[model samples]
Target: MATAGNISFIPLTFILSGIPELGNNQNWFAFPLGALYVIALVGNVTILFLINREDSLHQPMYFLLSMLAFTDIGVSLTTLPTMLSIFWFNYTQIYLQSCLTQMYFLHTFAAMESGVLVAMAVDRLIAICDPLRYAAILTNSVIAKMGLLILLRGLCVVFPVPFLTRRFPFCKTHMLVHSYCLHQDVIRLACADTTVNSIYGLVAVLLTKGIDSLFIIISYGMIFRAVLRIKANEARLKAFSTCISHICAVLVFYVPLIGLSVVHRFGKHASALLPVFMADIYLLVPPVINPVIYSIKTKQIRAKVIKLFRRREIGARDNVIATI
Candidate 1:
């Protein structure tokens, strides 16, 4: 597809795919996929609303949780539209520019989530390890700065991905394995020498997810050490309880991601459905699960959600009585 001097069309579209094994049954898959999307949307939105309405929750921990909720919404939006299109309508065509745009968003939000998780871990460390200094260290201005730094880091590093792809020639097959456009998934299809793209992709992963994960591990290590030093077992348990939700969030995000990476690099001979499921879990599972974990584990969120539903039920009953 290269012309003189290796120049080509400005925007070359490609066909996105779902599980080929399902064949005509792909439409049936839309129900569960749609349900996941709805759950993720409702859950994250509820988290955001709870954080916004509750003055008591206006702290560094909740601030970082709100940021995490925002990133979860972004992660869901980046992939859900195209995935629904493919599963429900069989609309598989995505323009080159559009694909790159999707990749940018999906990866950016993924990186941001990692950063937010690390921030939450640090918050927990301070709250547990040095409770007195927590307020002084994580002031409102400092939290604001952390949020901005996360955003800028996510956007700036992944900004060049699409531009780099533009320079390469996609002379090979244009078919992509997943419903969503991932940088690693798309870059392997290029015809030109992809050494630079591959190197950059590795570096990006290491810088964002890799380093963030390392920091999270270290923070938790410190937190557990601090908790162990407490004189009373009850006090230790209470302190450790605070980190359960965040620990769950970290697992949900990273486990599927690591599985997907392994499947991509080593499981070429594995079932086609394996990779698809891994990708789906990586993208969809965390957003849906994180909110539920928090709601169940954190008393504040649980109480608010219960009150929210009870209010709705009461309003409905009053409306019925008025009509009668």
Candidate 2:
């Protein structure tokens, strides 16, 4: 413990309790969790690669999707090392600085993900409500600026979290609830008054995810009204169909997020496993599922993915024939 003052000691490291109830059985989770991480990385990378390789996918929507994939990859990579270390090797101890850094990146990526979703919603709104001006409205330069703004927003919003967490003297037991460091989880261990931390955390959430969700809802509502005005049922259905994948992405991301927040705030007496499970779902599900939803629901993405696989299969067969 490092002495912060004459009377207080700040521990140099924090211990991560990876599902305390599981105990020795925590190792059993290693394989499944590792597999999910691997899938997330591969899926998101594939989405990005397809978007880059396919010229038809160079539109505003796919550009925002590539951003989303990049964010997902960041989220997975940020949590993978520490999480696997805890579950696979029982190396639950994380240095104070390391914990704070992880917390920063995790929250930053989360905020970026939210911003990308908002951009996607706006893309859909324009496409549905004003198809003629869609290309003019969301040009490549404009998309680039949006991406830059989202990155800056996330970076600026989360920049203070680690510093805030660092200023506290954590005299409470340094055992964190999850395998990875979270802002809320870390602040809870601080010995000092955390009213500021709590308020700031709430404010940060409201500023990023809250505002993003509101915009998305409003965008979709407008989209719905626009779609309804179309005289043909076929045209209305087609407009709605474009949103299926994004809607799924939003649900997957926000549903778990809401559940986790609810569990954190209101489920104190609830099963200890509840928060752990909710957090896992909140963090892990989006990255793994988003690509699949997009690939399945978005025709262009699905066709491109199938075409890529078919080309690989054909190349493999040609190589075998040459060997024979």
Best by TM-score: 2
Task: List the lowest-lDDT window of 10 residues for candidate 2.
Answer: 1-10
lDDT of 2 by residue, 1-324 (tens): 666554235678899988889887789889999999999999999999999998999999999999999999999999998889988998999998899999999999999999999999999999999999999999999999999999999999989889888888877478888889999888877888989889989999999999999999999999999999999999889989999999999999999999999988888899988888889999999999999999999889999999999999999999999999
**How many pairs of residues collide in each model?**
0, 0
Stretches of model 1 off by over 4 angstroms after superposition: 1-11
Global lDDT of model 2: 0.92
lDDT string for model 1 (1-324, tens) is 435444343437877878878876799999998999999999999999989998988989989989999999999999987999999999998988899899999999999999999899999999999899999999999999999999999999898888898777764468888998998788778766888888898899999999999999999889988998999999999999999999999999999999998998899899988988899889999999989999999898899899989999999999999999
Native-to-model Cα distance after best TM-score fit, residue 242 in candidate 2, in Å: 0.4
In order, the Cα lDDT scores of the candidates are 0.90, 0.92
lDDT score at residue 267, model 1, on the 0-100 scale: 95
For model 1, what is the alpha-carbon lDDT of residue 198?
Answer: 88
Residue pairs with backbone atoms closer than 3 Å in model 2 (clashes): none
Pairs with backbone N, CA or C atoms under 3 Å apart (clashes), candidate 1: none
The lowest-lDDT stretch of 10 consecutive residues in candidate 1 is 2-11
